[model samples]
Target: MLEQGDQIGFLIVSGTFLTAMMGTFIVAMVVLHRQRQVQNRQKIDNLKSEYEKTLLNIENEIQQETLTQVGRELHDNIGQLLSLAKLNLNSAKPEKQAEGKEFINQIIKEVRALSKTLNLDWVEEISMDDFIRQQLHRIESTGYCQTLFDSDQSFNELSKDSKLVMIRVIQECLNNAIKHASPDQIQIKIYKEDSLRKIDIIDNGRGFDTSIQSRGSGMTNLKKRMETIGGSILLSSVPGKGTHITLSLAF
Candidate 1:
């Protein structure tokens, strides 16, 4: 009961409608994809900004700790040496003059070494292995407890930000062992496991029960810091045996 011309017109209209609907759907999909991309980029930018801020804070803490150490060394070690040197010079006998001169040279060497420590630019220049060794040496120099460090290989490819966080975490573990636990032995181990790098700090110290201990021991901060770097921390402890902390990072 329809005319040929009318049927043709209806077919053309149906095709146009279908084409428009497909175009609209495709356009909508493109817009949605673009929006998601923008959102993801913004999220990444925010995370990067946060990481930079955290790294800055860690650097500041390192500087502060370095200053404290320098002050203590000056007051305790260098001051006594200089005092002795002055006394030696004042009592300058002909035979002892050469000895005093030698002592002064030794003092100069120590001062130079301390100066190197004060220049924290080495933080950026040093590799992970060097950094960990430097920290362990500091503990060994203190003469209170023995420290052992073992690593599979140098991790030179880690980002400075990751290194900062890792160093802070290790420092915290060392401090906890030295201050609270009074450990006689502390050991640090670093190795690669599959796609991850692992750092373990083990101490034969008086460790408290992780379940009963308050969170103020900085375990929460450690966990959050590791999470920010897309890593995780595991703490294991026994009441009298020891404590072991493991940090795993996806490099």
Candidate 2:
């Protein structure tokens, strides 16, 4: 019903409208894509910031604990040793003077060992299993409770930051058991399952209800710390039975 010239004009108008719509769509898609990229970058930066902050906190706490132990050792162990050495050195006998020299040498060695723990380098120098063994030994030395350690001999290669966080968490667990659980025996086991390295801290003690949240934030903080290191913590306990905590990290 229309002339050819009019029909050609109609077609040109439709084509122009379609092209404009497509251009608008393409511009919108590009804008949206750039916005998503920016958002993702921000999210990644936030996560990195949070991780560094956590590591700093863990380092500070571990150093504080180390300082406390150093103070105790200097006062109780080294101080007493020095007094004994002085008494021996003051003696008229040659044997007593020799014993005094040996004590002085032993003190030097101990001081050197304690000095190593003053820095964060020890975290990298020591493996988690070795640290656990040392802690158990210290606890057993106290004669407060018995401790047992079992391992599958699986080697875990953890980063220094992760190792530091894990060490602090394990220390907190052991301290809590000694302070609150009043257990007669504490046991630690390290093993590997699938792609995960696991450490279990078990104690036959007065267990509490895990369902009811504690007034203190200790357990909650432990869980958060593990999460930060791409690890998880599972706790199970019965009032009369015992408490068991499993810490798992992916290799």
Candidate 3:
């Protein structure tokens, strides 16, 4: 019904309107994409901040524990040794003086060993497996319980942060078993399953109900720390049987 020129003009107007609508849609999409990107970046930054804070806390705790051990050694071990050395050196006999020198040399060696633990550098030098074994040996030396360590001997390299957190968690578990569970035997097993490296701390002690909320924040704090390192912890316990804690980290 319209003339050719009129139809052409209508088409031109319709085309212009459609073009404007499409331009607005494209701009909206781009803005939305950018906004989402910003939000994601913020979330990542927040997580990273939390992780760094956790590492700092772990480092401080490790240093504190090291200091405590050093203090005890100074008072109980090294102080006693120094007193003996002084007694020997004050003696008139040459053999007694030689014994004093030997004691001094032994003291120097021990002091050097303890100094290594004063810094976080030792965390990098020690492997997780070695640390676990040392902890078990220490516990066994206490004569409170027997300890068994089984490993697949597979090498799984972890970041220093991960190793530190894992060490702290393992220490807590062992301490809890000793202080609360009163287990006769404690066992640690390390192995790889699929893509995950796993450590299992098992104690044949009276266990608590996992369903009940714990009055202490220890377990919750551990779970949060594991989350920061992208790891997981699974706890299983029965009232009379024992407690099994499985810690897993993906490599």
Per-residue CA lDDT of candidate 1, range 87-190, in tens?
Answer: 77777496566666777888898888788877566667888888888888988898978999899864667777777888888888888888888888899998
- Better by TM-score, candidate 2 or 1: 2
Model 3: per-residue Cα lDDT over 161-236, one tens digit each: 8888998889888989998898999999999999988899999999999999999999888898989999999999
After superposing candidate 3 on the true structure, give the runs of residues whose Cα lies further than 4 Å from its correct spot: 1-6
* Of candidates 2 and 1, the better by lDDT: 2
Tens-digit per-residue lDDT, 44-95, candidate 2: 8988898888888989888888899999999999999999999999999999
- Tell me the TM-score of model 3: 0.94
* RMSD (Å) per prediction: 2.7, 1.8, 1.6
| Each model's lDDT | 0.85, 0.92, 0.91
Please state the error at residue 53 of candidate 3 in Å: 0.7
Clashes of each: 0, 0, 0
In candidate 1, list every pair of residues with a backbone clash: none
Worst 10 residues of 2 by lDDT: 152-161
Q: How close is candidate 2 to the true structure, as a TM-score?
A: 0.92
TM-score of each: 0.84, 0.92, 0.94
